[model samples]
Target: MITTAMRTRASIVPLLLALGCPQDGGTASEGGPGTSDGTSAGTDTTVPTTSAGTSSSGPDDPTGDTGDTGDTGEPPGEPSGNDLDQNALFTCRDQPALPPADLRLLDRYEWTRNVGSWLSSDLANNPLYPRPEHRYSTYSDDEALDPSVLGLYLDSVGGAADSWTIGKWDGGRLRTVHEDPECQCFLYDAAPTSECVRYFVRRYLEFGALFRPASEAQFDALLAFTEGVLAGAPDVESRPAVIKRLGAAAWMSTGALHRPELGAGEPDEHGRLQLGDWELANAIAYALTRTPAGVPSVNRSYNAGFSKGDVDGDLGSILDAARDGTIKDPEVVAKLVEEHIGGIDEARLDLLFEPHDERYWETHSEYWMAHGVREFFREWLDYGELAAQTPKVEVAATSAWSGYAVENSYQNQIVGFYGYESTLDYQLDDMIARILDTDQDVFANLLTSRMFYTPATAGYQENETSIWKSTAEANRVYNVSGITPQTREGRWIELPQNERAGVLTHPAWLGAHALSFENDPNLVHRGKWIREELLCQNVPDLPITVDAKLSEASKSQSARQRMSEQIDADPYCAGCHALMNPLGYPFEIYNHAGFVRVEDHGGPPDGTSNLVGMPSPELDGPVTSAIDFSQRLANSRYAKRCFMRQTFRYFAGREETMHDACTMVAIEKAYDDSGGSFTEMLIALFNSDSFQTRVPD
Candidate 1:
């Protein structure tokens, strides 16, 4: 069940699914699957409440009033700067963003589907008739349950099952379903034609279906299981009957076991009671009579008796009892589920339906302690007494830190580094704690400046020529400029210190260089990043126009060249690319690998690469190292402002406008005054209004 691909694509599937698929209703609607109606399911009859407040607006609420706490600031009025609208930046609306309860329901549905698929597949050669899809509503009935859909559902369920298996199942094979005509309808024979098939089908029905349903008595039994499991109780005699009933149903459903006649004297080695055919025939009848709560109590009693004196057996029996009933108590089933399941829903699901994952708690705690940089700014903006509470502040600080860690550890690793494994634990922790514990004003001041990127060669090799390498060595020099030799021993050393001042002064241009190398099939992304991040320009999309020739002409050229030619062909493209293409052109010297290269298998160093056919300034730069490139970039005023804009956007999670000129000026001044220390810029942005207030659209 465990596969190598699962480990790598764990995050990818969910993200892609969230983005690609519409919500449960199959339209661009809010409140999709996994989102709760806010109140407890048992207490309130009202519709589920989402964190996204009461807005009946369609999913693409340009105003961004979808009720989520996070702000997606889209400035008002016609777009002006660089001809790009501020509204174009938000992408959060394109995803599922489900709540906890709904997520659990989705998990349950997927799990059931997975078990069903496995059963169907295993019995494919069997003569049993295939069941038709349940027709509940016209819409539901119309949606065909195709193999692909079933496969996706199965995959999700399998993931959850795998997660459960992690600490509990111990490599037990999943139960498989088969057909047998001799067994009564829904009666399973304990001794089947195939042991593997019998065991799998029995386990699947018990765990995947009967036990997961929500009913009154099942809920009670779930609570009981939770209490017993947490206490490590050895006796589970209270829930055995439920387990037996569950096993019986599963056995019957698969036709692997016949309904047994019950006149049981004692249980067998596997804790199953010996029964006559008549007893097995009456199993479902007995099960139907008991309410959900009644089953758990019966199961508990059966488990206690079955385990007798063995602690491990007692625990296993208790779990089996819980699994047999309709109790959804995660705590009782935590060990079982964890041992049997396979997915990332461990913590998120636990938060909704069970106890939270201990690993998540630990990771979250560490994350909070590591990233407190923005908290100080929030406090300074609020000017509240709560700011004095460093511990709480530190906790609040972890959100950003954890976000960065995940972004760096997962997203950046996959996209930016092309799956390179980067060590983030130590750096994230140290940076977060230090940022939080430091004086608020230090950070406040740091944000007021436009210094966001910290240049450090900390992880780079000594001989590396990347900007990170130079910055690391330079940071040490900046830290110990005039300090005594003895005192400086413990301090960080800086190299190329003067040359590498702030993000702009460092080899921040490497990002553009990196983009250039990708030769991305889509030039828009490459051009946009170059325009927005390098030249401080924003290229908003033009109105839909049927330009067949443009598309046709682009087929023959590389993305970069096509874009260059397009800019020349259109006045619209020309105006923007004039500010974008030149800045991005210098980066062409570096390949997608971010390595220096002389030729790109095309002619080299054409001086006539005009932006708008005006014979633009030549970007015939030599490729030696990222540091040399960084120094060359440092001369451009556009680079400086671009860094400032990027820092503001990153801190605010939105774009900057002319209205933010005051904050930008202050930040620029701070950066100039602080010798371009990265910390200075961060402080400046954090203290600004852009960081403090949630702007209205």
Candidate 2:
């Protein structure tokens, strides 16, 4: 009998098949990079090798590392990356049955991110836009199962290639041995200069997008589907049309694109598969840069399996000589920081690509053609979620006419405060850059840093004021330029340490978590971000049956008064609300604009709440304000461990499970031992058993 989980995936295949293949009737197929020729689009058919149970000894796969090449029914011992002894770690170290060997589909972000990597274009055109973010708060264990994403994923895949050009980014050269210039849409032909376009597209779907191989049967089905796409194109022979068809088909195809493993080696006696070295390389690459930078070169075998070779020509290709053995994990992270994240050393100049003024700082951050974790965090934090198209709502007018702009208050006032100049997001980008550069106690520094960048706005640029560090004092005792009466602009202004904290007090975060009409702090939201994004905790959704309403009748009372009446009264509400509300109340000292406030204008301010449930034994207690809370958070063991959990999720591309406990503990130990360095934490995760182990269904 099929299990419920098995049945769920079984149902998805037919639904995707029903979306139907490309429409017929067009110019005949022609040879292209990584493809073959045919008289008609649908007539040409080929069967690629299956992902499993295959031997690899191709020219490209000379090493033939058997790591991820084919299935070895025999169980391999636990993979590496585990620093702790299993017998001493936990009783459940020997997991009998690994997760089912279901295929893992890309969520919307990964889909766009992967394809964008292939094309060498920074693709902002994502189908997953304007949906619930696959974030820590909404994350569920079922998410790893490919079947869950089928319905929402279909439309995204179908139209994704609208802007794609096989040869656009890499100057149209489909180089296999080396990507002097590469193209996701461009396939490889046997000739050095020509394209085996069809063949290459299928392989890319497996290696680039799916991060796995496909079987002969799977390729036949995918080819049939691609041929169907040609049925509808007005001109099938159009090279662009064909290229788009291949990318879209592979992207949308459910079965091949979604193959997942517990991390991949043979099953253990308890039936466990360790994630292979191949996948470990991938996990490290994607987490740091948010692309398939770590994937090894494939053999020409039918399944096109793996060997230990670097990705030919992309951002990570820079590490070709060092990735395999020379560099330790910390060095790997160091290289990524220097090359991929370049914004930290400068201030952002929105209109000009390069800075004209000399006194301010290095204001040039854009690299001609590149994508990285900076891009990933842009989506990860949903910083521009309010600015997305399709869900067109008037944001400027919503604060008065209606409180219904999609992200008006959140985006416009906070992240995009200075119109198109997203100073806040850039600030965040800088923070990540700095964290990676220093790579020590990253979580604590992020929470406690007093450094911030203030742009050289019109006032300073126009000579109305000086853009110097001394000019930008954050304390209320002094002020500066007319535009920024509280603080001036330019460089990394080190504020008075006691008066400021990290991003929690940042205007972007504060504004994002506040209201439009009342312009008050949304403690629940502010607190939730900390719990979910930082601590990796989930405050369960309010029960649907209950209205879960907020009361606002205290006209004479302050913002907290209105919320306290409703949220604190219901025992059912307290179950979840308590986790968030406690931390949120501390931020009442700041307004939506992120300016300091000693008093509330309306009534007495109650900026006090119990800081409880942190994993640390002594850190849980009453905190006086957001300042105190942030400082305590920087010191808490729970917060640091939680930071690792987020790292695992970011790199692993899945939420951490109870089964991941030993891995998490080991990573946390590395963090502790390494003086809480983010670099070491990353090393710990990539070098662990979980990083290299795969679990079969």
Candidate 3:
């Protein structure tokens, strides 16, 4: 837990700013210190100059040799491939241990992606105008998994192996099957029937025996076997042919095999299809394993010449008969339908369906519909279970704060309920409202008293009247009558003992500041601002390890002088500051007013500045574009971890402490397990013991 003294000290300046009552006689517009050069004073030293002549090798250039080890200091040898020491691929040990809950969370993220892909495959080539593209829009059944529907979809799209191709097809032709190179063996001539059986079997084995819920050794063995099979050369002429032959041969039997003969298909009065027992068995097995050649089996009709309505009516009747016991066994009903339905020609099926009409069929009866149903059922089940097992943590309704406001005169869209005259004023008002609405007594009290209006102490001007009014409202509402006049001195200041406790409230304004100043290139800056203001984390002073030689030699200094110097000077400071500074520097464009300013103190107004001394020297240049900054921020290690931690806190609804290492570890692990989704982390946190249980104070 953070110390009270630190919280008090941090709360004073912000509280005064929040009160709309400034001690300084000057108006808010006449704010102190609009901009600082951000340079440190140091003694000058003579440095050698280098010519601007082009060279094959430059100080910042990467060595082109494959054998070049660079400065990583890693051993120059092939990594061991053994499971105990699998150094070739990135192992979990190489990185910090993520929470186990994070793994489950990541799985949820991947599951969503998988479901999205499934939905896309179902909706591709759909005829419906403005067809739903996302999974939420299509194929949700809200029930148990409809294996039959899923199987039909898999058959039409050629299973997961052909998901990419399936995704390319429009909804108009969902039933229209295409011969995919990936699954050519399952649809082509000279493709043995046994090969189709083996292909499905292999898929099942891979999914069930090799993936999660299976042991690592089992996974390794399966992978090894697959690799061996792929590496081996067979007698087939082409790679596809080899794959087909291997698939076929794996399931073929050399001895005498029992074959079933097809009978003239007509049902008796009892509605049972006139099929031999052996024939029925064969058809059942085929339905389970055989890949459809052209159209999906669901849309295929045994009686193709019949009217469209009649064909649909017949299917409905058949299904109804099976349900009502008029057809007795489902297997019998299935057999009768198969015989009556004319088998679609694999090659000609695509030609029969109009591309424009296919979307309706998919929407009405496809995997997307089924998936939606499944999701609904899962949610229902989970909700019931949660209600029964866990006590709900009640959070009061809070004001929504709109961070930064872009002055879009054309759009008059209002977000938060707090109505201020201007966008900036509205944002500040919204922040004050959120602080007032906090459910925690300590947090609420702190925000209301010493920490409410202190934007200026943290280097922001609180000249806006709308901001001041909201702060006064919060103070009155929370009944903090005795807040000392001395506490309202600066934009940021420490709170007195009678004012407040807890670190969350002191950082609330900082959090608002960070959000208000957010821009793509300024992500690092936002992060640094958050760290300094909210968490009160100490950021070390800048060092001087930059390319002094280059800067001293050239009349025009290199763009990365400030960043490079700090990184190169002290190795101890290099790691943390390097991580923090670049992330913060990107947000240099946001000034004290919480408005986007394209210029730094001495640079161009377009916020195209760059940081030097990064892991890659090639990236050391002026970041003149938002894309460059966004990519750097998104890919930063600290940004990723901080995001994870914030998500954890939001869902867990509590401060993390050293004693909660196991929970933290579990949460981080879960994030890694899941594919890093905010939603997944939420679910994992909700399902965690820390979230479910109430700890005694």
Candidate 4:
């Protein structure tokens, strides 16, 4: 069957690809043409690239000859196909392994996204999800569940279940579900003649609860409850009884609230407990993305329409097909790598194109990259406080925005959130995706590439629009070295140089890491993020007795001047501050307001920066600016391994430990072998024993 998604995409594919991928007006391939079998799917998904990640020169190639492959040693015009192999200079070594932890319990973000998939619709568009508090981190669910959080989940889940059954209770839905079901909602609604509701409930419980259907015991118990609900019903049409039963299961059931993947049976030949289909599905989705199982892969939005014919509901279909060997003999173990984990389709590749406000794509392209990292950058960079970003702090002599405070919430908004957007957030996020998706040397593209998107009028002196944050007050000054603004409200891609190379200079990272009125960038925080997140090294937490604060006397000097003098004066604070201050001072190129500047209110900016404490022989030591640091970082083996290490912790939801050493080595190898494909690194992790094995209950 041409899936509903495929049918819809058949017509719009050309338009979407043309907008972003200049090389993809023709039928394209996914993850390039180098599949395990080395055969192409021949789907109109991506512009096929050579094994080295360069666009293929074919009759349909829309992006013409990429100039010269000459010396100067850049990977031709395609520029490393996302610059995947940027770390070719570093010597490969066995790196420290990542630790795997029991990934139990649904994080709040996962819970909400999964709920929408089970029901096969975007409930957020209907204004159904209740946000008790803003979510900054995916791990917030690891903490003790709050009463308000539980309440929010209960209400939203119930609403979703009710919405599905209510919309489908009429004739043909039951047949539509059983003949060829879409998601669990249709599967539940397919129950014929109330007598078989128990059998269907068992199936859904297995699917939605994140548990195995080892016995009929749980199904029998739930059936008893359904019989009780039906007993209160009037006569023949006991549909209300079924809906109520499904709703209850969707909320109160174990799988509904927790990620319970109990150990099942004998150890595989590898000694890892073989996870069941449901467990595998849940884990795979959690590792790669938090989007609901059945959600479309791209152009998704709150207002995006929901159709009943879609088959992307849960992991059951893919896993079941693999086991039965129905289509091609799928090693389900490797299926996790090839299809879901490693592979890319046209939908995702299309997200690279900015819509220009005319195409009305359903979702943004960058969500794929964001979801891949277990650590959400919004929380990591502290941009979750986007709502609090205001015009209160006037940037010094920074054009019209110097005194005018504009807080444009329409930055780059993700689709499912209740009508929110931000260009600065999206700009950085899209850059991350472009890097990970395009090439090897993934870190090279991630750190050193200077491309970014921004409003055409970001630097314009005049503005009129007003919304959550006054657009006029919020119109950002385009002060980065490499970018040039293209439109008033839309984003255009621009590549910058020097300190503009990586996310360190992106507005989202800069804005989130800065102080409100301190105006000077927080060197300590910036340095800390680099040391921990990027370099994968831990600086000891400060002592409780020690309060490292800038004295009033010190505050008058420029941030650099004050910081340098203060650190020099205090022997105790100097130890940790040394790790962060020097590394962070490079970003003094931009103010805490996220606009570029040569100096701060305090002192002249220090143009020189360094990769302090980096253990890599090639990457460590002095650098000139953020751009220089980004280039060195991309070239560092230590930094690249740490990045992959971060990728593992994010998906596995654990810290790196000795137990995970061997598997982490496999991941490191994949990064090197795949020429820096971030997708390859993820595939290696998912396919490893650490991701598949669980601790026995």
Winning model by lDDT: 4
Which stretch of 10 consecutive residues in model 1 shows the poorest summed lDDT?
A: 97-106
TM-score of 1: 0.33
Candidate 4 residue lDDT tens string, 1-697: 7542242233223322211111111111221111111111122212122211122335675443423232111222523111223243123344222212222445544554444332233434322231234222333113322344444443444443332343343321222123234334323443345535554454444333322331233344455555555566534455644554454443443334444333344654543454544455546665655532333222222222322223323433443442332312224545554445322332443232232222323223333453545245554445545445654255433322343233332232212122222355665665665665575687777776666655433332333333323332222445522322333224545544643667777767776777764435377778778876776556787899986677787655677777777774588888878777777877777666566665556355565765545556786678777777767777777777767666665566544344455666778887788887776777677766556654331
Q: What are the per-residue Cα lDDT tens digits for candidate 2 across 1-697?
A: 8542243333334325422111121111232112233221222111112221122225575443334411212234433112222233333364322332323334444555455322223333333332254553212223332233345444445434443443423321222323423443232322222243345544554444444333334455555655554445435246455555565555544332332333333457756565433334444554554444423232212222111233342344323312343233546545554454333323232112111222222432321112344544454444534323222222222111223222332333233322222345455555555555676786777778777554323332224434322222222211112233222234345666544677676655665565553323367778888777666556777677987445455544555765677666768777788878887888876654455554564444456788666645657888888878888988876666655655666555454454566677778777788776765665666655555554553
State each model's CA lDDT, in order.
Answer: 0.29, 0.45, 0.27, 0.47
Looking at model 2, report the run of 10 residues with the lowest lDDT sum.
20-29
Among these predictions, the greatest TM-score belongs to 4
Output the lDDT of residue 409, model 3: 14
Please state the error at residue 620 of candidate 1 in Å.
15
Writing each residue's lDDT as its tens digit, candidate 1 over 1-697 gives 9553243244223222111111111111111111111111121011111212212235576442344322222223534234443223211233211111010111122222222222222222222111223111100101222334433333332232331121112221222211113222112333223333333333333233332222222223333332333234223342222232223222221011111111233443433332211121122112211111111111111222211112111123333332343222324323332222112221222111112223222222111220122222222121112212221111111111223222222223122232112112222222333333342333232212222222233344335434332222222212222322211122222334323322222122222223322343223433455455445554655547734234554554444576666665687656655555544454443333222333434544221232332111222345233333344445544455555665564434334555555666767776678765444555555444444322121
Residue 501 shift from truth in candidate 2, angstroms: 0.2
What is candidate 2's CA lDDT for residue 300? 18
Please identify which of the two predictions, 3 or 4, would achieve the higher TM-score against the true structure: 4
Q: Tens-digit lDDT track for model 3 on 154-220?
A: 2222122232122223321112223223234433434334444344323322221111011222222
Pick the winner on lDDT between candidates 1 and 3: 1
Who is ahead in TM-score, 2 or 3?
2
Candidate 3 ranges with C-alpha deviation above 4 Å: 1-527, 530-583, 598-603, 606-622, 625-627, 650-676, 689-697
Candidates' RMSD to native: 21.4, 12.2, 32.2, 16.3
